[model samples]
Structure formats: structure tokens, C-alpha cells
Target: MNVMAKAEKKISSAFIYFFGSFGGILFGYDIGVMTGALPFLQADWHLENAASLVGWITSAVMFGAIFGGALAGQLSDKFGRRKMILMSAIVFVVFSVLSGVSPDMGEASAYYLIIVRMLLGLAVGAASALVPAYMSEMAPAKARGRLSGLNQTMIVSGMLLSYVVDFLLKDLPGEWAWRLMLGLAAVPALILFLGVLRLPESPRFLLRKGDEAQARKVLSYIRKNPAEIDQELASIKETAKEERQANQKTSWSSLFSGKYRYLVIAGVGVAAFQQFQGANAIFYYIPLIVQKATGQAASSNLMWPIVQGVILVVGSLVYMWIADKFNRRTLLMVGGAVMGLSFILPAVINWMMPNMNPMTIVVFLCIYVAFYSFTWAPLTWVLVGEIFPLAIRGRASGLASSFNWIGSWLVGLIFPIMTASMPQEAVFAIFGIICILGVIFVKTCVPETRGHTLEEIEEQGTNHGRVKASNPEN
Candidate 1:
């Protein structure tokens, strides 16, 4: 707590936190870049009428991410969280260039981009799986939410940056604009790769591998009181020993068995709902949505994403501020209700007045995005990082992440088709129902994890015959 000690902690915290969650920026960039790029892509390909191919191209990253998350999760467990992230960043930078050149494939460029994006998605999915677990392990429990929430903050900031880049490049020839938007992600990916090079391995992972000296050394930079560093190490060692003695299996199937089952369900279900609630339909295709609703010109479409992106960035900042101060379940339930209502009211207005101004739909969707930014967008990862037992944290995080991508893939692929066959509001109404169900899932399954250590959460899970007392009985 001395002034110089405080200065050192601040510097160390900044380094670890920024590099630790920097992967989120790459992931968010892909999300926002596509929103703007899609319109320009249509301009070059003249695929304005080919909805299926466009949907496939848009959904490709989420499709690849499904396997990437599951694979990286298990691999990070065996190899180490930091190593997998480094590998993923390298892959992301390389594929980003390949994605930029897809326009060279002539008529087949759409399919080519799809193939490249699926490959690039491996890196995106891996980052999604790795960042949360890495951040969780590095952060102390009392401040874990704020630190881990930094991942979401970085993600939205990336999205906002992509929007600005897309706007800047919009006046370029159609093919070149989209190409640069896709390729520009390489710069940030390279920065992440360099930043991570200086980071020490997770202290917990080091101890598990029997490198106590290195683990203590890394913990020293993170903790001011030498005794506090030793205290956490001893607690971590004790928890690992108890789990080993109790014969808890880290096998993939073990997630569904006995004690780990309930926690896995809660963690993975939240991850799934975060996507299935259908936020990506807006993130991926907002420009097209605005055009169809209001008869807005294609040239004017890129501006809308900036407006929405700003809301998301601001909302994430708000979440970081209140993250440690509020209960997780309270924020999730309230946010979900508002998000569901945002979708429902728009649909209802469209139903009641077929001639309703298209701007009204745009407004409601923005409202949905605003609520999601503060709630499920950030909190889902927070829970995914916290709820799993250490023995299977990596594997479980992978499972949760894969489910998340699966929902995202489905929403991205089908939203265009659904809108073609039905009213936009009608499609959104279905998403509204999904959001409400997500609120109920939070009420039933998730336990409050605030103000508790990972070891304490594990021991509490042990004491309960089924779930913690905080989780209500069925």
C-alpha cells in the first residue's frame, strides 16, 4: 500500500489487463467490420439479390468458431492459456490478409471468403475461449468482474474502431474498401502477438505444472504483500489437492457428471442464451435492416453502424463501472427483460401499423443492443470464467464457448432467410421469446459469485450436496 508499491501495482495491472484481454478487440473488429463490409461486398459482387450466399459468408466465422472454441479450450488446458492465445493471434493475422484478397476470385469470391473466414474463425473462436479463462485466473476474485469485464470493453472498442475504419474507407472503390476493412485487422492482431510475448504464464497454470518458483515470481508482480502472494498460492495448492483426492475427473464427459454437471449447465446455458437471444442479427446486418425498413440508400447505410457502435462502447464502459458493485443475476435479469421488450414492442408496433416508420424498428433494435451491451454481452463471459471448477475450467470454458458460437452461427445464418420469408419484426419477436427464457435460466441456475475466491467457490460447491444455498431449489 506504499506510494511506490502502489505505482508498481498500477503499472503491472495495466500491462497484464490490456494484453490479457486484447484478443477481444480482434473478435469485435470482425463483428463490426462485416456490418459495414457487407454492403460494399454486395456492391462489388452484385449479390444484392443472393441472400443465401451472403448469409453463409456472414455466418462463416461463427461456423468455424464452433470447432475452434472446443478445440482451443481442450488444447489450452494441455498446453497453457497464454501459448494457445499466441498461436491463435498469429493465425488471425495471416488469414486476415487472405480474407482481403477474396475479391480476386471473380464470381467465386463469396465462397472463397467463406472458406477463409472459417479458417480465420479458428483464431477468433480460440480467443473467445482463452481470454476469459486467462483473465479469470490472473484477477483476484474481489475485483474479478471489473478486470474480466475489460474483455468486453476491449471488444466494443474494437467494434467501434472498425466502424470508423469502414466509414473512412467507404469512398474507395467498392472491392478495395471491403478488402482493406477485412485486411486491416492484421495490424491489431500483430500488436496482440507482441504484447503477449512479455506476459508471464498464469500463476495457477504454473503451479499445476510444478513450477512453484515461477508461479511465486509472477504472483509477486501481482500482489504487493509478500504474505498475500503466499496465502493465495497455498489456497490454490490446497484446493487442487482436495479435488485430486476426491477423484474429480477432468474428462470432457465429466462435465455432465455429478458435481460439475450443475455448474457446467449454468455456465454453458448462459453462453448459449447470450447468442440465441439474437443480438448478432443486428450486429451483422444492421445496415441492410435499416435499408429495408426505411428505404434508406445504400450509400447512407454505413452511418447507422457508427451510431449503434457508439452505444455499445458506452454501454460496455458503464458495465465495467458497475460490474463489481452489482449482483450478476440482478443485472442479467433486468437487462434481459428490457432486451426482450425492445424486440417485442417493435414487432407489435409493426403488426399493429403496417405503415409504421422504419426508423421506429431501428430505434428499438438499438435499444436492444444498448441493454445487451451492459448485461449479457459482458456478464456471460464473466460467469463462464467463474462458475467452472478449476479441474475442468479449460474444457468447460471450451464447451461453453462452442455453445455460444453455435447460437451465433444459427442466428447469423438464418436471420436473413427468416426475414425474407417473414416480417422483420416477426423474426425479432421469436428472438424476444428467447431473451425472456434467458432471464428465467439466470434465475434458476446461476449462483452469485461476487466477493468470493475461486478456491472458496470450489469449496462451497463441495459443501453443498447439489448446489450452493444461494441457488434456489427446483
Candidate 2:
């Protein structure tokens, strides 16, 4: 009987991790699907000369995400994380189908498609903000980093799947290929919605809502020993009580208060830098970069994204192994240095030998992707999940995620224009500089959050700030 119970508990735990991070699959799929679809869309719609429209088409989703992230944070605070995830899945399914079936009526069709993609972006942004927080709240403190890192793993997996799907469907006649690529997102969205239906509400969220009985019940399924469960519940209740006494409303204004100012800077700064380092330029526009480098047709370059996707998945596996073992700050510093060198080397190589093989740039890009997958991509989510106080975590994470999407939107909107006006090497040099700055930010500002409970981290952040202010000499 005890053996049967242990097996059931293990299965339940696995189920939670799988479904909890499924939103990331949708996030990665939407982002990667565009990389493959854009080439075909350009050819079909006669957008070769329309750099502005192409940029808008690619970035419209990110713009929509800026709003979605803010709104989902507020909604998840009130309606619960599980409901918000369900809402995001529904949004993904409806808009994905709409994006696929957009009327091919010339420039008008491009405008219509932008509108649909923005709606899809709304879902992606919400999932980005909500999933990590949900997973962090539900996971054990010891395993939180690994479980939260699963979101990144699923994200890369989704990207890999989308790339493979695009490669397989590249030969389809007319616009159906891009349409299928865009519409296929509905499959995973549906799966997420159904999977989340069986999941319980987050215990921390339940405790915050003054439902101790339900919180304990939920904790029982996730926690192993009853003693540990009670201890955690007591800690949560105490945190909730303090939050109530503080009477701090969760809002943008609250995030900027003296107490949370530094944390806000660290979280939002890291989130923005993750995008500004130009990884998305590779993920979203790699084929275009390849087309410029090798002078090859975009259709022939589908395999390149698959190669990068493999590297992303492999790097994420490495991250899972070390995430809980090392200080988050230490990993970011090492990753930032490697990532900076990767970008800088490519620019230097191109400058020294302008006519070098395009594969050289591809090799550097693969290196950049490898370092970034384990570091900024996964760790950013982990920090955002771990750094914020419980009182402001949902809204603060939303704001941080908004900054991330905003940076992504800027990169997606401007990269084609930059490439059109300047050398690709110059463009990458700019990102290399940003990567160096990212390393500095990690060293000076970001906190170490390995192996700490969310509540404990919050207290330490608050008290440390107080101590620093009181003892400026230290």
C-alpha cells in the first residue's frame, strides 16, 4: 500500500511539472513559428521591398504582449494563476487559427495578420508572466530552480517542434504552408487548457486569499511529509499575515516604493537585457541573416534554425543540472562573458575577412545560443520568480515581463531596418557591447537566490535594504 502511494505521488508530481510549464511551449512555438513562416509570407505577399511592413508583421505580437503582461499580472492576482493560464491558452487557440486563415488580400492582408498576431501575443505575454510564478509557488524550495527551469526547456522544445514542422511543410503549394505553421499552435494551446483543468490552485495563492484549508489540501498533494507540509503552511500564513498588516496594495506604484526599488531595477533590468543582447534577432530573423550571409534562398535555410534549436535544448539541459547547485549570480556572470565573446568574435571575424564563409557567423551564433539558453533565458525567469516579495510578485513579474517584451519588440521592429542600412557585423557588435553591460548588471545589482524559499528571499531583500540604508559605511 505504501509503495502504491509513493508511485502515485511521483506520477502526480511529474504531471504538475509537465502541465505547469506547458505555457512555455506555446510561448516558444509562437516565437519560432514566425521565423519559418516569415520567408514564405514575404514571397507570397510581395513584401521583399517593404522592410517597414515586414518588421511590423514580425513585432506586432510583442507589442500586444506588453499590454497582456500587465493585465495578466493583475488578473492572476485576483482570479488565481490557474484561471489566467486557461485564459491565455484560450487566447492562443483562437488567435492562432485567425492568424493562419488571414485573408490574402494584398497589403490589407498584412494589416489583418498583424492584428491577429497581436492577439496571439497577448496570450504569449500572459503565459510568460504567469507560468514561472505559478510553478515557483507550487514547487518545493529545494527543487524550485529545476522546476522553474522546465519552463525554459519546454519553450525551447516548442521552438524545435515549430522549426521541424516548418521544414516538413515547406514544400506545400501556395500560402497553406505558412497558414498551417501559424495555425498549428492551436494543438498545444488546447492541450495546455485541458491539462491545467485538473491541476489545483497554487497553495501560496490560496493562503493569500485566506483559504487555509484549501491551501493545506493543495500542499498535501505536492509535499511529501505531513510535518513539512504543516511547517510550510505555517510559514505561508505568517507571510500572509505580515502582508495584511503592511496593507500594501499590489500595483505599479507599489513596485517603485523605496523598499522594492532596487529589486525592481534588478528584475526589470535583467529581463530587458535578456532581449537586448540580440538573441531574438537570431531566433526570429536567422533565415534573413543567413540569406544575407550565404546569399542563399530563405527556403533553403530552414535547417539552420533546427541546428540552433538543438543547441538551445542542450543548453537548457545543462542549466537544469546546475541551476539549483550554483548561485544564480555566478551563472549569469559566466554566461554573460561567454555570450559577449561569441558576438564580438563574429563581428571581428567579419571585419578582418569580409568575404569569409557565412558558416563562420553561423558557428558564432550557435555558440551565442548555447550560452544564452542556459543563462539569460532560463535564469531570468528564475530570478523574476524568486526575487520579488510575495505581496508584489505577480504584478512585479508582469512589469518585468513587459520590459522583456518591450525589448523584444524593439529588436524585432528594428533589426531588419538595421540590417538594411548597415553591415550585419556592426549590428552584432552593438549586441556584444550590451552583453558586457549585462554582466556588469549581474555583478552589481542582481541578488543570489539559490536554495531559498520565496518568503525567505523576500524578507532578506527587505531587511538587507534597510540595513544598507541605516549603515552606509558597510
Candidate 3:
């Protein structure tokens, strides 16, 4: 027992876990910072004429992420997840500093911030994909779910921290509050960079690269006994060989035909709809939306975001309890129904009265957020992970992630323009409609993944997707 303690403590699993999931915190912080920074940024840069570019500035990071995720997969496969994450951390820190201090070039300052943000988006994109793989690779099989769930927890917590920071600094004179809010994201990135230096290369990555000796060493540190270490190493060797052989047969074209086509559509569709259901619309613009609705001066309060951030974090915690306990399809459809109703109520009320209390709209939006956090947000990835064939898991997961980010990018870009042209409730009405479509999509397309092993899902989906595709009405 003493020796086992010594072995585990030598590398410190907690230390490894912290840095492994740290990327989520950075990504979350980046996500929330803009909510506070945007109003001040527009004021500081005098971006009145370039209001059209506001969406670009808000969404440029997501746009850059599309390319970042694509490249990170190939690069990480060749290099390593740890190395690529370190590179991403460096990029986050540098671009964050640049974003905070973007020079005032009149309206072009928006363009400058947009460019900086898009570059930073590269890191955000990489983290979204890499963190899960890194955390999963480092964890033992029995604990994989709990450990991987930490990444999601950290993401929402980071967002909450950013909101708190924005609230604390709301009173600072001039644009300094927003600058500090934007720039401080570098703090976590820097810590992640430093902390990751102590992290060993994942044993799975080592074994894949034919470094069996190093892989054995890492397993010793992470596992309890020789039996556990040897068993895991052998399993990894087998899985790695299967992945190599499978990679040879899989390609982008494979996802277009056979059972792969139907599965990919379902997987990618759920991923895309998770974002398109209008979660980020609320996440990124809660404060601004509240102020616009309530006629509350921006300078007077930035508190609504803090409230929503709490709901997101709390809701994520609740998801952890119910994650493996329920049918994912049921939870998602129910969430969609509730979310659609939440948005529709506010939209209808405002359309009829046009003078309803702004707080009432805020309440319905919160309800939308509460359901979204546990259901589609986390379950999309859970279902995606479960539905793919073992050989194609890596590729399919990447594809789904890309679709997710693209959906988020489109929503972020379009929501502001949507609200500007229509009444706020009208915009909510559109999102509500999308939420309803999400429910139908799940009912018709997504498979129930509860109580099924990965092999079972793939085996069933192999013929099922083909039959469903052929019959159409089925």
C-alpha cells in the first residue's frame, strides 16, 4: 500500500488532471469574456458605422475554430495531444493580450479585434476536441466518465468566473474594466501552460508511437498494481492496432454511404442542433439582452450574466447525476419541448402586450438555459461518442465537433442581426421554432443509446441506418 501511494504520488494524478482539463477553463473564460467586453469595445472603438461587423467580431473565434479543429486532429495524431495543447495555450495567452489592447483605429478597430479573436479561436477549437481525448486517455476505465465530466464542469465554472470578474470590474473607470476582463483570460492559459509542463505524454499516445517502455512507465504511475498496469497496456496495444487497421478503411467518403451515412447524419445532426437550438445566443448575449429589454443602463448593471452563469454551472452539476441513469433521447426531447415553450411564452407575451416586464422575459430565458445545460449540451457528445463504430470513432467525433462549432458560429453571427431587425420576442420565436424542430429531429433520427455498449450501438446502427434511409417513412 505504501509503495502504491508512492507511485501514484510521484506524478500526482491531481496535478495531471488539473492541467489535462485546464483547457476547458480557458475556453470557457474566452466564451464569457466577450459578453462583458463587447459593449465597452463598441463604445471605445466607436464602432457605430460598422455595426454590421459586430457579429463578425463576436463570432470570429468560432470561425477560426473550424480550421483549428480540422488541423489539430491531424497534427495531434502525428505529434501528440499534450504538445498541441501546450501550443494552443501559448496561442490563447498571446492573442488574449492582443485582444485586450487592440489599437483604436476608428471603425477598423472592430476589424482588428475580429482578427485577433479569430486567431484566438484556433486555441478554443483545439481545446474543445483535445481536452476530452486527453482526459479520457489519462483515466482508468472505471473512472473515465467521472474524470471526463470534469472538463465540462470546468468549462461552465470558467464561464461563471468570467462573469463574476465582469461584475467586479463593472465600475472601473473608462475601458479599463473591459480590457482587464479580456486580458485576464491569459492568467489561466499561462497556468495551464506551466502546469502542463509537468504532465507526461499519455501512455496511449506513447504506445501508438511504439514507445512501449515509456507507456509502461506512465501506466505504473497512474495505475495501482502491476496487474492493472499490464492489463491496461495490453488492452491499449490491441485497441491501437485496431484503430490503425480501421483508419486504413475509413475516409470522408465513407460517411456518405452505407450505414455510415445514416449514423453520421444522426450524430452530426444532434451536434449541430445542440448549438442551433439557440444556447449560445443566450449565453453570449444575456446581459445585453436584459439591458435592452429592461431599459437598464449597461453602466448601471452587469448582473444578469452572473445569474445565468450560476444556472449553467448548477445545471451541469445536475447533469452529472442523471448522465448514465436515463435514456439520452428522452431527456433531449423533453428538454427541447421545455426550452421551446420557455422561449415561445416570452415571444408571445411581448408580441401581444409589447409592454410586459423585462424581468418576465429574463425568467423564461433562464428556463430555456436550465433545460439546455443538462440535455442537448452534454448529451450531444455523449450520443456522438456512443453511436460511432470503433474504427471510425476518432474521425466521426472530430466531424461532429466541427459541426457543433460551425452551428455555434452561425448562431453567434446571426443572433444580433436577428434581434436588431425584429422584436426581441420575434427572435426568441425563431429559436423556439428551432427547438421544436430539434425535438422532431430526435424522434425521427437519433437512436436511443441508453444501456447499450459501444459495440452494441454500432452493431445495431450498422443495418438500422441503412434500413431507415431506404424506407424513409420508417
- Count of residue pairs whose backbone atoms collide, per candidate: 0, 0, 0
Q: Could you give the candidate ranking by lDDT, starting with the highest?
A: 2, 1, 3
Off by over 4 Å in 1: 1-11, 242-253, 257-261, 389-392, 445-474
Q: 17-120 in candidate 2: lDDT tens per residue?
A: 78999999998998899899999999999998888889999999999999888888888989999999999999999999999899979899999998898888
Clashes of 1: 0
The numbered model that scores best in lDDT is 2
Pairs of residues clashing in candidate 3: none
* Candidate 2 minimal-lDDT segment of 10 residues: 4-13
lDDT of 3 by residue, 278-360 (tens): 88888788876887788776545568788888998888888888888889899999999999999899978877887788789
TM-score of each: 0.89, 0.91, 0.95
Rank candidates, TM-score, best first: 3, 2, 1
lDDT of 1 by residue, 82-123 (tens): 999999999999999999978565668888999999999999
User: Positional deviation of 162 in candidate 3, in angstroms?
Assistant: 0.9
- Single out the weakest 10-residue window by summed lDDT for candidate 3: 42-51
**Top TM-score model:** 3
Give the Å error, residue 387, model 3.
1.3
With a 3 Å backbone cut-off (N, CA, C), the pairs that clash in candidate 1 are: none
